[model samples]
Target: MGTASSQLDPEVTEKVSRDVNDLISKHRVVIFAKNICPYCHMAKNVFIEMNEAYHWVDLSKRPDGREMQYFLADLTGQSTVPRVFVNGKCIGGGQETQELYKKGILQNLLNQS
Candidate 1:
């Protein structure tokens, strides 16, 4: 007797969670966001423009996406859309993301880890 968001398929959730964790763990950079978010688009564009490698989690249809969002909020202490994680460290939202790119710290972070 729970809402869809609270009743996600355990297998699917596990798979998605594993995929996300793997991307973050194996890769140097990761971005989590909804597809329609403008900031998400901007962040992606910046990465593309810089030719940086990154993984993206699109939560537009996944039932447990809200759960993932909550997890990000708890992990990063901010619930902003397009939450970016660099080498398992939360680098914050869109503007901060851009600033890091501008300062070239983002590239350095990727190079280090």
Candidate 2:
């Protein structure tokens, strides 16, 4: 089955894009996730284990969640949840986060301010 249409209205896409950009710029770590996603929990747990602070948007609880997901896919080339960004760059999702952590590179990225 094909993915759902990602063509949101220009104004809406612009607004969502701006909002997402603002979040990335304002926070050292940002995770775009769905509340019930296990991968989301796994990704967030890494930060918790390291005692690091992060900002997360639970898209499942937001009115524009689907749009945001679509926007994230467009930005990161992944339509999955737990899209984690650190140092204003897409580090990828849960599995990728775990991999980075194991490689010790995730710490280096977090150290950048």
Candidate 3:
């Protein structure tokens, strides 16, 4: 069965896709998140502790938030907040990000760029 995002208008979906891609391309690290989500906070804290700067979109605060989340689900195969990208690649979400941080892999990913 098709997902809800698949039911979205093609034009809107395309625009959101392009806009998101542009954001990802423009930042070395990007977190697509919702403000109240603790998982999102955890992910953000990882970068903060590393003293690395990142760009993050608070999906809950945007008019297009729901569409963005749907787009993320389509792109990453998961529908969760704190969808993180390093160097324009999906590195999974909060707990996954925390795992990478624990293993010291996240830092390495950051340093590569």
Candidate 4:
């Protein structure tokens, strides 16, 4: 399978592809989310508590949200929202983010190479 992009109009898919790439490249943290997703909210809370700002892509509000989520599934190996990334790497979702927080690894990951 190529990616979720294949499901979209090729033009939109291409643009979202570029947007996703730009986001992961330029942001320290990124979350692919829907507006009402609790997990996505929880994930954002973790970063906020850290006093970190992240790129929050509210897919529900975007025309390309679904396609982007599909692309993210390919990138992170997960289809769920609240897909979190740090330092240009997929760290995971709500529970995973919390686990890392509880272990004190989240801080380390924030700044590590």
Candidate 5:
């Protein structure tokens, strides 16, 4: 699944693409992260400390995770772990997420939703 698949089924591609899109679009606050990433913990903690709820997908547990990572890069212009989204909009990685929280923008988004 990592390379060109001459015999790949179209249905499979469609389903995987839809799965990726759904994972990103279905949540108010989406954090695509790896379980062991420190930045991932930091991002999640920000939400926790603020008493905010967020949806998180640990890509390390998915078979199509790398594909989703690439998909995210194309869709959001960044591919790194902890791709944080607020209200279906890409807010970026750990540093960016924390920074937004510090500047009070993240709180506004949370309230808006």
Candidate 6:
């Protein structure tokens, strides 16, 4: 997988990079994933259930999203869907996100943000 910065068009890439940066800068949690992905769905569901506010980027819809897919692959070395980020840090995929949730660390991060 390529980094989000690598897969985007000059314009879209700039936009997404800014978007991700702004999200990390303004919000506590951000999730980047495809709508059809089950793990992505689960991650969203968890956030919804907890009533936590998060920014979700649906890479399947946007032209720049393909770039994000590559970015995810490059960073994680896995082709898994639903790559998440917290506080400007890559937090891995759905299972890892869930593990953080299970460990009660997700809430802590959210709260801290």
| Root-mean-square deviation of every model | 4.0, 2.3, 0.9, 1.7, 3.5, 3.1
lDDT per model, in order?
0.77, 0.90, 0.92, 0.87, 0.80, 0.75
Which window of ten consecutive residues has the lowest lDDT sum in model 3? 1-10
- Per-residue lDDT of 1-113 in model 3, one digit per residue for the tens? 78767888988888889989999999999999999999999999999998889998999898888998999999999998989999989999999999999999998898887
lDDT of 5 by residue, 1-113 (tens): 34332134566556666886786678788899999999998899999989888888898998877666766676677768988988878888999889999999889988887
What would the TM-scores of all predictions be?
A: 0.78, 0.93, 0.96, 0.89, 0.84, 0.75
Q: Where is model 6 more than 4 Å wrong at Cα?
A: 1-16
Leading candidate by lDDT: 3
Report the lDDT tens digits of candidate 6 across residue range 1-113: 74545645677666655665676567667788899999998888778878877788888997767766665566567767787777777777888888889899888876665
> Considering TM-score, where higher is better, how would the candidates rank from best to worst?
3, 2, 4, 5, 1, 6
Q: Taking the tens digit of each residue's C-alpha lDDT, what string does model 4 give over 1-113?
A: 56665766888777877999899989989988898999999999998898988899999998778888888887778899888989888889988998999899999998785
Q: How many residue pairs clash in all the candidates, one count each? A: 0, 0, 0, 0, 0, 8
Note the residue pairs that clash in candidate 1.
none
- Flag the better candidate by TM-score, 1 or 6: 1
Full ranking by lDDT: 3, 2, 4, 5, 1, 6
Model 2 Cα lDDT, one tens digit per residue, 1-113: 42332467878888888989999999999999998999999899999988989998999998888888988888888999999999899999999998999899999999887
When summed lDDT is taken over every stretch of 10 residues in candidate 2, the lowest stretch is 1-10
Off by over 4 Å in 1: 1-20
Query: Best TM-score goes to which candidate?
Result: 3
Q: Report RMSD for candidate 4.
A: 1.7
